[model samples]
Target: MRTNLDFSPLFRSSIGFDRMLNALEAASRAETIDTWPPYDIAKTGENDYRIVMAVAGLSQDELAITQEQNMLIVAGQKANSDDVEYLHRGIAGRSFQRRFELADHVKVVGAGLVNGLLTIDLKREIPEEMKPRQIEIRTGQGMPKAETKQIEAKKQAA
Candidate 1:
């Protein structure tokens, strides 16, 4: 079951928040989806993150990891184990696929599997042009008014 949410009320007051609203809507809709192969997302550093998933009974070959733009996908399909018979199967050997939405400039740095756990490392690499930079405010005493005006004019022309 799904419910329709009227976002018009929220949209009327917010400016330049369309992307954020869309992201929120997507997350709300995903709540009804499956959560197989439990996973945890954690922040390790200032701009670093890690996603750990419990994927027992799966090898590196059985799992696949892919990233398309801002989406990260991890899938696993267990091989045929019909040869081994078990009276009662407790461990889950089923296949599952998980997706994660990464923020801008966030990238998957590496991935590894150890002790039935899959760990994926991520880092947000903001470009130099995008990173916050401090502007050096110039004081009038440093230069004469004429030079400052000429510099301003040159900058305007450029």
Candidate 2:
């Protein structure tokens, strides 16, 4: 059973969050969820993350990884071979594409395939201007006083 959620109430009061809300709605309304070629996402460090996907039988040349803005795309296409005949086929060798939404400032650092597992590393690098900084507050004793000026009325002419 699938349940649909209404995000209208949240949209009415929130601003500049339309993309997040739309993503939620789209995820909930998806007719079929892909579960093949299982994957896992882990937070290895404070600003570092890793995604490990089980892409058994796929070679480095057969897989592709791309990063566009705040999105990560991974796709795999296996070359077809008809010379060998199999009595029973259990392993999945079909082409698949998976997309992941990344947060602001997050970027893909590196990727490697080992023992049929593809590991992707990511890091969030905040710009110096956007990072939080401590501001020092001055005491009253060291503050500079404002310069004051006095105005006098002109003498009346005789």
- Listed per model in order, the count of residue pairs whose N, CA or C atoms clash below 3 Å is 0, 0
In candidate 1, the residue pairs with backbone N, CA or C atoms under 3 Å apart (3 or more residues apart, or in different chains) clash, namely none
lDDT of 2 by residue, 82-120 (tens): 898999999899999999989889999999999999999
Instruction: Report the backbone clash tally of model 2.
Output: 0
User: Could you estimate the TM-score for every candidate?
Assistant: 0.80, 0.86
Best by TM-score: 2
Model 1: lowest-lDDT 10 consecutive positions: 147-156
Whole-structure CA lDDT of model 2: 0.96
Model 1 residue 35 distance off true place after TM-score fit, in angstroms? 3.1
Off by over 4 Å in 2: 144-158
lDDT at residue 21 of model 2 (Cα atoms): 93
